[model samples]
Target: MRCTPPPERRDTAFALILTALFGACILLSIIIPSQICLARGGEAEEMNLSSDTALSKLTEGNESPAQEGIPVHVYITNNDNEKLDVSLFIDSELIDHKSISSGSDQKMDRYLLEKGRHTFKITWWDEDVKSSFEVEETRDITAETSVHLYTILNDKPEEYEITVNLVNENSRELEAFLYADGSFKKSKKVGKESSAELGKIKLKEGIHNLSVRWQDDDTKIEYEKTKKLMVKRD
Candidate 1:
């Protein structure tokens, strides 16, 4: 026959059991999920920008030395629950950077850019991705190219565009110029990582002169090309 324990002893054993159960719950709360990936800001603050960051650029007038350019607008939205650090680049040049809060969006101010193809790259990371340690330094996102609808000039009702494809290089900038009937008509500046286009145009259904010019970044020499483009009915 088993003998019953004293009341005091039974009460102490019950207290010990209660303490063990509480410790187990605390451990589970801290370690059950193991890892959490969150996109948090580099700092607790709202924003951080580069030194040369220009939110927006004013249009250049004809007398101004700056080349006249069009505006490029970018809109980004964060659908995640955590904060995110984002960097923006144009043609391999770092333009701006900021940390956006969770469930919000950033409408990047319009930047003046020469009319042509441009590479708009955005590298982003979460705050709690892997380790807090320098995730921005080891960023792995490649810049994605953007496309826009461009209007062209044409003599006939039918119209077509001439696209200038260039080798993609982060260190090189290229430009292409087009002339029709011996007069300058169109020109395009290709950013470091983008392809240029001459826009859509309808020719006069005859032999026309087309020229392209750019400097060889590797060779440090100027290059030019002239071609005779024939336009006719199929």
Candidate 2:
């Protein structure tokens, strides 16, 4: 018998090898698409988390809160539903402190302060689940308030009129009231449009308890100042 060349067997082997290669290429294409989708989804999630964190920090004011010298008993109200830390300062130095609840108003007793200008600093802290990872916001509330210096003097009893020269330390408007025998005798607005109340009150010959009250609408209390003078008939 003559040995044939086995051409059919050779052709069958070549076709099987080609089929395996095509199957491998299809599997690789499918896996590549799945990997690319996973990567994009992960990146999107990270970007969203970063954006949310940035917005939360920005909507809140500046971090690292502080303030300078402010007035004594100023009205402070917390309009948000968060705890607030309040610090009182005198000439940029920390002195007293307090905490206020949300949606509540309270007054500070600034009477402990000396006669000078001061500032108040307030800070808001985020309620942290972990104390180490907390954020804070600070704001400085200013008060140009100062003690009113006033003195009621006779100048000269013979002048027959009380001379009340008011020297206001602050830029705000000042008012003076003359009280005699428990009645408001006279009142005048002083400072800037500075005024003088002369020849308005006539004196009687006796030791009179003349009370001079100086007050400003910005302050909480009336500055009690008094003087006694004896009148002599000319």
Candidate 3:
């Protein structure tokens, strides 16, 4: 039989080879950046760059039409050294907002609006970032008017008494309908400070939505109020 190296020497030689290979790997790692290098560490997390949840609307009005509507421009910046994806807002209303890579800026514009103040909002989301912003501005509207109305109600067992107060602050007379259970109960004129009292009504109580409608006024001016009343016997 041919002589062969002892088991211990063979084991030692194999171990030395493994050590050399490990050292070479370490040197290469120190010299090269991996394609899958981590962009950022997990020290903190961010949210969506376009995820926002607040909204606001403001109106502006001018006695004379010659005035200008509001003009507004909003700007967003990635203030963090880390690239940020975020949204911006004016007064809780959302404009176009976006993700900003690190050290970048963005801008958006909207009508300042007339007769009321408007809310602007911005939003964003990402795997590790979430943010938002807002602003408010006022502009003048030349020819439109607004009126707000409400209802007062008290409920008794198997019956309800409701008082509808209709007021028109506009220079023109306004009319609207009072409804219950999808049926028109009454139509009344609501002129400047003119209001009518609707008599008591009996209703089976659960969940009900009360809606008020009028024409010749801003279609955006519909007033919807919800009331939850329970009917119980004494």
Q: Pick the candidate with the highest lDDT.
A: 1
Question: Count of backbone clashes for each model?
Answer: 5, 7, 47
Which residue segments of model 1 deviate by more than 4 Å? 1-67, 131-234
TM match of model 1 to true structure: 0.28
Please report how far candidate 3 places residue 211 from its true position, in Å. Answer: 1.4
Predictions ranked by TM-score, top down?
1, 2, 3
TM-scores of the candidates in the order shown: 0.28, 0.27, 0.26
- For residues 1-234, write the lDDT of model 1, one tens digit per residue: 222212220001000000334334224333442222333655333333222221111112313376555656665555546666666667788887777666676875667776555666666654433422111211212233222211111122343444433333434555555555557665666566645445655465557776555566567676555667777655
TM-score winner between 2 and 3, please give it: 2
Q: Candidate 2 at 170: error in angstroms?
A: 4.0
TM-score of 2: 0.27
What is each predicted model's overall lDDT from 0 to 1? 0.47, 0.45, 0.42
Predicted candidate 3 versus true structure: per-residue lDDT over 183-219, tens digit per residue: 6666666555444553455555455545445654545
Error (Å) of candidate 2 at residue 21 is 99
Q: Comparing candidate 1 with candidate 3, which one achieves the higher TM-score?
A: 1
